[model samples]
Target: MKFFSRLSIQSKLMLMLLAVSIASILVISYVGYTSGKEAILENIYYQITELRNSRARQVQSYFNYVQNHAITLAEDPTVIEATVSFTDSFNQLENEEVSSNMISELWRFYEKEFIPRLQMNVDGNPTVLSYFPKENIARYLQYHYLVKNPYDVDNKSRLDMAQDGSKYSEIHQNFHKFFRSITTRFDYRNLFLVDSETGNIVYSVHKDTGFATSFKDGPYAYSGAANLFETLQNNRERGAFEVIDFTSFRPSYGQPVAFIGSPIFQQSNLVGILLLQLPVNEINRIMTGNFQWKKDGLGKTGETILVGSDYLMRSQSRFLVENPDTYFKELKKQNISDRIIQRIKENNSPILLQEVKTNSIEKALKGEEGLGILDDYRGVSSLVAYAPLKLSDNLDWVILSKIYVSEAFEPIQIFGKRVLVTSAILVPIVTILSLFLSRRLVMPIYRLISGTKKITSGQSNVVVTVPSDDEFCQLAGAFNKMARTIDEEKEALEEQIRKNDALLLKTLPAPIVKRLKQGEEKIADKFPHVTVLSANIVGFDEQCDLMSAEEAVGLLNDIISAFDDAAQRHDVEKISTVGTSYLAASGLFVPRLDRDKAVIELGLEMLRIVRAFSQEKHLKFEIRIGIYSGEVIGGLLGKQKFIYNLIGNTAKVARFLMIVNSVEGKPNSILISQNLYEPLQEFYQFFKMGEIDIPSQGKMAVWLLSDGSHKK
Candidate 1:
């Protein structure tokens, strides 16, 4: 107390101000630090998640494009025509250009359509099976069920010798040669055939060149042919995977390469296995390129890598080595201990840690995606993203991407440090000015209090007069103005809400209406509904049954247009059409106003349209519709995909009723569920029919609309 008394009043004020300034700076710094840390972490996590999603989409896109191209190649009338012609004239060998043209066409398909879009390097464009009708591999598998046991060694040897020697045999060498051409045309080095029934290794691409060695004496070879069968059985039961060791030869390095094994399935039944071998280096290169990282300053800081479900390093783009031994040692030197190694092995995806590897990789292996970042774990800092690989049979291994903290978050840290330094220099000057103009601050504070009082009284247009060069005074004036503007805008916003409510009521049902108003959730809920209607042309089937296929399709399309018009007029929603059956429904998101009435009205309108259609187009049978109503559920089921549907008991009943009601009643008839009939008894005309049996449903009472004769 005595020490304080010795100081002058001005000195005391300065000391107090200095103390307050220091405390303010500390508080600001702490808050800024915490906020920056959280922001940086969130940014890293968001980026990793985005990258994983992008890669998944890219993979799916590639697959879809490949499949579409395959379908196009299969369906080209030219290919089909060429194949048919070749099959018919094959025994006679009448046209060489026809076969040459077919090959040329396939070559074009490969160069123009497939190679540009996908990573697949085909040996050649796929060949049409029609060109080799007797040796049609797809069809052969289609017809034959795999026999668990096919043959003994003696029988297999005799079959192999016969197959190797015969030229015009169903398993023709020329066909194999042509297939090899197809694979090579696509730049694929490997092409092989699997005996669909027996799982035996048939002719490979190398065998097509007439350079072959029998799998007889090598350690990789089966002890006897019996052992080969056993291996096939094991493969069939366990599913396909990369074979680490197999019977095959390679260049100078005898080290085993990766072999992708694919099980052949015909009509949903496993037939055999096809094995394609590529050097492990090849797969590593492709995988690396697919998930390659990009960094602003450093070359892709987060290394794109892969680990097998077994937790072994499968491939790494940034960390490459011919052998695992040296790399394992290197990891340990970086403080990744044996325990860390074991933990990493446990995870299949990218992981981060200072003490231990996280389970993000394990989740990915188990078919769930996960990502995270950790510091000082195992004494190393890292940020990681992990995703499961797309595998056919086994749990897909996890792909892990990681970058050291100093590398991954370097930019953010640098920026944050700059902000802190700038703030440290600027805040003290601002604080000193604030202390000197205490009197000026009092004037604005009083004016602000007055403005706030007006604002509270709902006079939002009130403005405060502030006179000062200080930024705080300017900020108070701006805030006062902003408040006034905000109050005026609120009125306009309320009006907009009223209009939106009206629109929503018009577009959605009662439940959706209430939920959306409360802002509970935006996605539509799935609910069960009970009716489905499918309409089709009645006599057009018979009329076009004998007509040319193209002409028949044209005639059927004309009839379906009339059905669409009727559906539109009656406010029914069309789901899809199969052949002549036009499927639709009346009650989906919008429940039926009068379920029975809606069904009857739709049936009558369809009859009217089909009658008009017959008069205009000279069609015989008009239209037959199938309507059944039963309990089924429908809603948007995915985050990224949206579909609105009708489902329930009523929907099923509507479908079943279409056939039964139409068959026994008139040219067009509406069928109603028993529940629907009970409600509309007083308003609609109907004739009660006893219980009837449906295909899937046991029995239910049905009614026929009386065509407005016996109302109620």
Candidate 2:
């Protein structure tokens, strides 16, 4: 402590400044770093969540279009009539001879060619359908429907039975051509019609082994179409649409497929089901950007994945589609379980094969929408935003948009490093500057100290000199001037003190002014019983109109000044004067036993003062005085332009009696309410003035004081 005390002021200031500057730098750095990082994270999360919502809406809109298309196709009159006729005819068939034997040929073809190939591909086990190649299944199904020779003979035979050019052959041809054109134009995997009553596949654009089989009892009954059939049967509305999630579609050689079906109703009875197989590529295009992720702002590890209620991926993974090597490497780095990796390797696709059970996905499937950081399907920590895709009641899929957490926060990390480096370089520079500033600041102060010491030792003429025009030099000049005028300053200070005291006396009561000068924050007091008096100069406004503005103001000022002097003589507090009305109170600042008598005396004195002024000026003016005695509350009113004011029923009734209900012709009369008259009746003589109504206080008894009458 002694060492610090002995140090020069400049050295101490330099050390203190350096310490404070370093501390401030550290605090600012920490706050800036944390706040900047939080802002970046918040902004990024907002952008990612917004993007996720946009993509989800787009996917929803696409599906809505597909659903409406299916419903429109189902409600077509031609399609509905043909489906109903075919369904009825097939259901009633029992040993009917067909013209071309095309049905028999289709059954034969399914039994011999399509069934053997499917069984062989599945190693003679129906449960091994997942092993079959989708290409082979598509080829078999295509041949049965596209081969024209078998159906050409049937067409010729049916044309011979035409009545008005609307033969069965023409209707069937038109329907086949329409289905082919639709399937090609819309990029549908397959278009099929199912018998609503029997749950059988009545017709399909791509016929396969499942074509001639009942959907409920066929080898491919477990396909998504079976579920679609059941849903359509339950809902017989023509526009009713249902979606079946991706599954091992047996008609497509156990390839992953989804179905959207709308019920075909004819005259309120369900005739058939119109079903469209949704291509996975179409979904992948909508979700993963058609393999152009970079253009879509999904960087290397950013992708949008669709997950179903079963926890399976509904859309193809971007990494798997565009960069399989990178995807595989990440899978290993994330330490995903080998069982799942092996399944991915075997299936050669993650769509409908990979299971994603992250917290975001689970919450989304439960119908909650949110964004957070969680490990995704590949076991990589990522920032994921998820929302449920509410296409219909049957489709329970959640869309997830994600990016790796490390990548998302990379900019923040870079910014922190830069701030740290900048701070490292700035500390020494700040320390050096602080030392220089301390010297500049303390040198002038040292001179001022020397001058002050000299002056303290009776060298009153000593002056400090600093060579710059800054505050230090100004301060030195002020010190010098202060030394030269020390005695005069004392006299001026005394004068200022006297003026301040006078001003304070005018603003507050004597005791309140004393307490306030002693540093009291508030000044207020309640006088349980005090007398309030109000005197108004009658005909003052008319007199002012007849006189010049300045003359009128001067006369009113003189009249008020006279009243103020009279109030002082009676020891009454003048609250304020509002043009032509003078307000004063007694027993407020200092309690008195004879407050009512004091107030009446003050009012009589004011009336006398006004009369003297009127006679001296040769002006006809009268003063009406009203006095009331009751409890009153007094306090300072404002912070600036403050005044000591009194308020209560006593003050209110005094104003009402003096101004509101004063006798117009007898302006020199003093009006006293019953409350005041009863108290001072013996000291002064009064005449009964009858009753006058006062607002808010009801009727009040009034008395007019007789001229110069005293009973004392």
Candidate 3:
């Protein structure tokens, strides 16, 4: 007590300042830490939610594509006519003597060969024939035998006869070709045409155990195939499609399978069903991005899973794909059913085929979309973003994008630790400095405070000059040095930013580049009435082969650069250049009513530019230009090596026009589709070249741009 009473005024002031400084630092640190943590967590949650929604949209688009394809197939004239003809023929033969003999032979084979195989494989289940009456089975067998044998005199081997032009053989061959093409083009597991009236499987691309079988009352009547036919019968809408969940498809040897079926109608009358075996690989690619988690911005512990309303996964699992052994161990640890585990072990099928019950799945199935921290199916703590996906009336699937909570919040945890350590170290240093400064800091403190105020007010050149030979002067000098260094670094950073902006401008349009620099994550736009021009230098490939690598590259660059100058002159946006092909468009980022005119002018200028360059280099160069006017969607693709690209039927048709109409000798041939000609017919002179047949688009009128100088 006596020592405290004898303390000097300076000592008391130092203690007070030290205490106040430490208290302020603690309060500010606590507030900053809490606010920063909350903000980071909120950002992460939003990012995951957006990712989940994006994936859901992609899945929906895939399903829409499948539905549209199925509808188109069902509406095909050949499919409708063939189904009706086949049904009529089968009905007419029902009362024939030959049909009776074929039925008797089939019944004998069924008893001796089919039932034994069915019993051996399906555990002697009586349900195989429970719904099938003997008469119905006999009728179905008769139809199968006739179609398969075609011209068998004696009901012996059902091998195809060498009758090249038999009606039966022609019908069989046409149906086989149609089914094979569909299967190959779409990469489907199988394609089936089921008779609507008889419920018999008429044709299949890959005929397995279920081939030539009746779905109505046959051995496989209780499967998804039967259910799909029933659903189509109940729904008579033209474009309606029915989806079946993944199950052990008997035809594919117990491999997990799903189906999509659309009704085939002939003149508004139900004829048959066009069924496509849904390819799981396509869905997996959409869900997990081909198992490329890192490319998808999902780091080590992140994955996206799809769950159907039945609690089964609709897509493959990352854990299973990356580490099957670890997945098996985890499944066993989670106490999955022995039956499912055994199936997985024996067949090496996806774990998604097994039921998965988790909090996220339960919520999503109940039409809930949210983000939360919960235990996933593997009983691991995870941060999950989940949404309900209503692909169609029959498909009630859910998408879950999840990552380990530890990984999701790892950055926050690290930052919090760093802040805590910094505060702990800084608080003591600040207190010690406060005490020391309070002892001799009067003059230097005033000088530093004045100079710091000026610096904070945007005066980077402020210098604190403390002439005293003490620590205060040294501290002032250090402050001035830091200010100068910060000024230099600021200038350097601005220069780097300028360079980045210029580089970005070269890759993307100016407006899009500005938006991206302002932190726009995604850039995409849909232009309803845009004109796309695709120009390719004819014989460029041959020319490259003849010239040296450097010469070829230099020549290509010069040609593309000339085209770029023409595009800029006409206000047309250059989309991209690949090899010798230059793709440009009008009304893409910026909308203009005269987009077609702009594109035409650009195409003509490009022809002139190429001709001049060819004359200058003494090289024989010819250019073909194709322009099509329609809707298009453009966007930036890929995170690394990103490119701004365009897609749609318009882009495809334009490129096709260029390739199909281009000739080697023609120096400047500009082919325009009917769509483009319709709008510009009055403004430009185009010589009609008659109708040209285009795949998918059918026959269309085409014209050659003759005189671009004439304008209406």
TM-score of each: 0.36, 0.52, 0.50
Q: Write the per-residue lDDT of candidate 1 for residues 1-712, one digit (tens) a residue.
A: 8897897554456556666767777787667767776787677767656655554455435334433433343334433333333233232322212344444544443344323322121123433331222222311221111111134311211122222122223443334455455445543345343443533344444322111212332222332222333444466643333333222232101222334444444434554444444344434444455434453111345554555655555554353223345545556777765655543333322132112234766677777766666432223567767788763343245665556777656666776687678767756775575456444446676677777787778675676767666875787868766876777786677688788766554344345557656764544444455456766666677877667898788766766666666666777665556676666766755776654456556766777766776677675765665555545564423334323344455555565666666576556555555766777777777666567886566787887663442363
Global lDDT of each candidate = 0.50, 0.74, 0.75
For model 1 the local lDDT of residue 209 reads 13
**Model 2 regions lying over 4 Å from their true place:** 1-15, 81-173, 207-209, 266-269, 289-300, 333-348, 435-712
> What would the per-residue lDDT of candidate 3 be over residues 1-712, giving only the tens digit for each residue?
6775687655666667867877787777678777776776677677778778888888888878888888998999987887776555445434434356655565554454445444432323533344223454334533354334554322212232214233444565556666676777787888877888878776666645465567787766888878988899788878778888776565454566788899999888888988898868888887788778888877877788788888887788888778888888988898886666666666555534567788888888898888889898788998889989987777788898888888877777787788788878977887778677775657677777888888678776778888787887789889989878877876787789899887776667777788777887798888898899998988777767778999999988888878887788899998888888889999987889999989998988888878877788777777898888889988888797667788988888888888766852145878888888888888888877778777678999988874344566
List candidate 3 stretches off by more than 4 Å.
1-29, 85-170, 236-239, 345-352, 420-712
**Of 1 and 3, which scores higher on lDDT?**
3
Task: List runs of model 1 lying over 4 Å from the truth.
Answer: 1-6, 56-189, 194-202, 206-218, 222-273, 278-292, 295-299, 319-329, 332-358, 366-368, 375-379, 423-712
Better of 1 and 3 by TM-score: 3
User: Predictions ranked by lDDT, top down?
Assistant: 3, 2, 1
Q: After superposition, how far is residue 464 of candidate 3 from its true place, in Å?
A: 29
lDDT of 1 at 524: 44
lDDT of 1 at 259: 41
